[model samples]
Target: MAVDPRGVDLKRLLAEDSGEPLVMLNLLRFAEGGAESYREYARRLSETFLPRYGGEVLYAGTGSTVLVAEDGQSWDAVIIVRYPDRTAFSRMVADPEYQEVTRLRTAALAEAVLQATTPWS
Candidate 1:
């Protein structure tokens, strides 16, 4: 489970850019005592990095009462973030300061799914 993006991942994301706003869906499964750590990471992201990189968190919430899913498919949390473009997202991940902050997220997640989405036309 990858909690952080690698250089090649960023490169690939940029390569697939369509010059449109991108929405990223995050499904997180936390490690032991990881919720607090993730909260700290989220704090830094909302306060500094998101603003610096032109990104906004559209939704963030803890998962509960799974209506439909296979066993072990439940997530501890979910987040939706929108970025002006793929370039902005990649740049944020590449930022030296953001890289430091991202460590918290890495330590907080046992498994994660970060998927980019596009609006239906």
Candidate 2:
């Protein structure tokens, strides 16, 4: 099952991000046990994507519990990447190299949700 860990309104959360002028952003709750390859994915993300576009990433955290207590932590990581805007984000998603890591990105996620947000305040 997917977990809802949000405690803040992301649109509001990003109100001050004028750096890249994020158009669309994705929130990822990577499944537990991806520790082995997380670094590799990060490397790919940094080298292959961030620079290609104009943006930065704000990683949330790693929770220490699961959906059900005693089940233990299920999320390997939590990430939020802000792109230059909707078009840049879309272009990044359609990039060939990103397509290659789609599987690994899938394998690492128990489930995730992406959102389109703008400043609320």
- The residue-by-residue lDDT of candidate 1 on 34-103, one tens digit each, is 9999999999999999999899999999999999999999999999999999999988888899989999
TM-score of each prediction: 0.96, 0.62
Q: Which ten residues in a row have the lowest lDDT in candidate 1?
A: 1-10
What TM-score does model 2 achieve against the real structure? 0.62
Error of 2 at 71 (Å): 11
**Deviation (Å) of 31 in candidate 1:** 0.3
Superposed model 2: Cα runs more than 4 Å off: 1-20, 23-27, 64-76
The whole-model lDDT of each prediction reads 0.94, 0.60
The regions of model 1 sitting more than 4 angstroms off are none
Backbone clash pairs for candidate 1 read: none
Query: What's the distance in Å from true for residue 52, model 2?
Result: 0.4
Best by TM-score: 1
